[model samples]
Target: MAFFTGKVALVTGGSSGIGRATAVAFARQGAKVVVASRRVAEGEETIGLVKAAGSEGFFIKTDVTNEADIKTMVEKTITAYDRLDYACNSAGMEQQPTPITEQTEETFDQIVNINFKGIWLSMKHQISQMLQNGGGAIVNISSAAAIRPIPGIHLYNASKEAVLGLTKSVALDYAKSGIRVNAICPGGVKTEMFERFTKDNPQAADAIIQMHPMGRVGESEEIADGVVWLCSDQASFVTGQILAIDGGFILQ
Candidate 1:
């Protein structure tokens, strides 16, 4: 049988990058997928890709930072699938690289609201729905910056570190309830986000690639594969852990 033959999954930020890839992964594995994002067009594109992979998929316009939107997302999932089997909290934003001393309050708040609070809000609604269904799996997309500081992107680094903490805390609090929570710390992946980061900072991009002992940037699909495994029965015993999908970057 397919690993996720009858599962249902919700992927936040599913319009692009890691979230988009993960959404496609779930659909390919036979899960009914709900791809949520702020961009309707991108969300529709993600749904098309999921359908091409031979799974049922739909798009939901969502802003993860909004409580009402998150609540609506959870409601829609339950109404459509009757249960929430898995959720990937991949919605986030990275601030423009700026020295700490020069960072503006507006940028800092925007980063925190979307990257940190967004995940928290997603978890809040998703967990509640999962509880009604007996159990579920959740994966939050963190970053290598969570463990190691990135000099210019201090705010981004801090937000991801908080994601790590949130993952562990949720895992412990809900283990007995049959809900598994984990986080993935991905290295530089060749996504639109990475491309944007590198557009003006070629040197930064090159240095990042060099740090990865694997000698290349990671692919979004590669990180998505990890998300699939974590949500599958194959990872039944895994919880409260930070899985780094970096190309050996953490080693050195």
Candidate 2:
């Protein structure tokens, strides 16, 4: 039987990029998938990919910043699958580079609310369900910025670092209860966000590529593969850890 043959996974921000990739990966392993995102059309497209992988899939229009939407997202998942087996909190946002001196409170709130607060809220509901189900796994998509300082994006840096703190604490709290909570710190990835960030600076783009020891940007599927492994029984002993899949970005 497939490793995840009877499992169910919830992936927030599943409309595109890493979230979409992780949802598809779970489905490929025979798990029914719940894809939660604000973009209905793109989320439904992800479900199509999941169905193409031959596993059942559902979509929930969710805004993680809204507590009610998050609760509904979890409820709808259980309503469809009866249990929650795994979750990937991949909903995140990155603003254009701005100095801290010029940063606005509105921008700070936007970044923190979605990137940090969203994951916390997600875990609150996901853990409650996992406790009832006896056990499960969760992967939060943190960033390399959380590990090392990055200039021009102070808000994004702070928000991602905060996610790590919360991930470790929650993992420790629930480790004894059979829930594994972990975070993935990915380096520069070739996503729409990355593309948007580097569009105006060819030299900056080249600098990013060279920063990774791998000599290239990471792919969404690469991160998805790690997420799948972490959520699988193979990683049962792993919790309260931050896995850096950053291709040596922090090493340099």
Candidate 3:
């Protein structure tokens, strides 16, 4: 049987990048998938990809930072699949890449609410459902910046650091309960967000690439593969850990 056969997974920010790839990966492994994001059109597209992967899929318009929206997203998932097996909390926004002094309270709050609080709220509901269903796995998408410095985007770094803390604490709290929580810290990945962030400065992009010892940026699918393994039985012994999927970027 397929590794994830008879399983159900929810991917937040499933509209694009790592989230989209993870949703497809789960579906390809025979898992029913629920794609959640604020972008309705993109979420629908991701569900199409999930269907093309030969598994059933559903999309819920979700704003991760909104408590009501998050609760509804989980409720709808239960209504459709009857149970939740795994989840990838990949919904987040990129930092504006400005110095700490230039950053305003507005930007700081935005970063915190989505990158940190969003995951907390997600875990709160997801864990509740998983407990009811027996147990499950959760993977939060953090960043390499959480471990190493990436200059400029201090707020982003702080937010992601909080993600790791939350992941570890929750994992420990539920270690005996069957719900496994972990975080993935990916290094410079080449995604639409990356392109947009660097479109105005080719030199900055080149510098970013050179920072990785692998001589290249990582891919969304590459990270997605790690997420799938972490959510699968193969990683049954793993939890409360931060898996850095960076291409040796932190070594430097």
lDDT by residue (80-152, candidate 1, tens digit) is: 8899999999998876678889999988889998999999999999999999999999999999988877778
Cα miss at 58, model 2 (Å)? 0.9
Residues 1-252, candidate 3, lDDT per residue (tens digit)? 677999999999999999999999999999999999999999999999999999998999998999999999999999988999999999988876897778898998898999999999999999999999999999999999899967898888899999999999999999999999999999999888788878889998999899999999999999999999999889999999999999998889
Off by over 4 Å in 1: none
| Clashes per candidate, residues 3 or more apart or on different chains | 0, 0, 0
Model 2: how far residue 120 lies from native, Å: 0.4
lDDT-best of 1 and 3: 3
For model 1, state the Cα shift of residue 83 in Å.
Answer: 1.1
Q: Which RMSD does model 2 reach against the true structure? A: 0.9
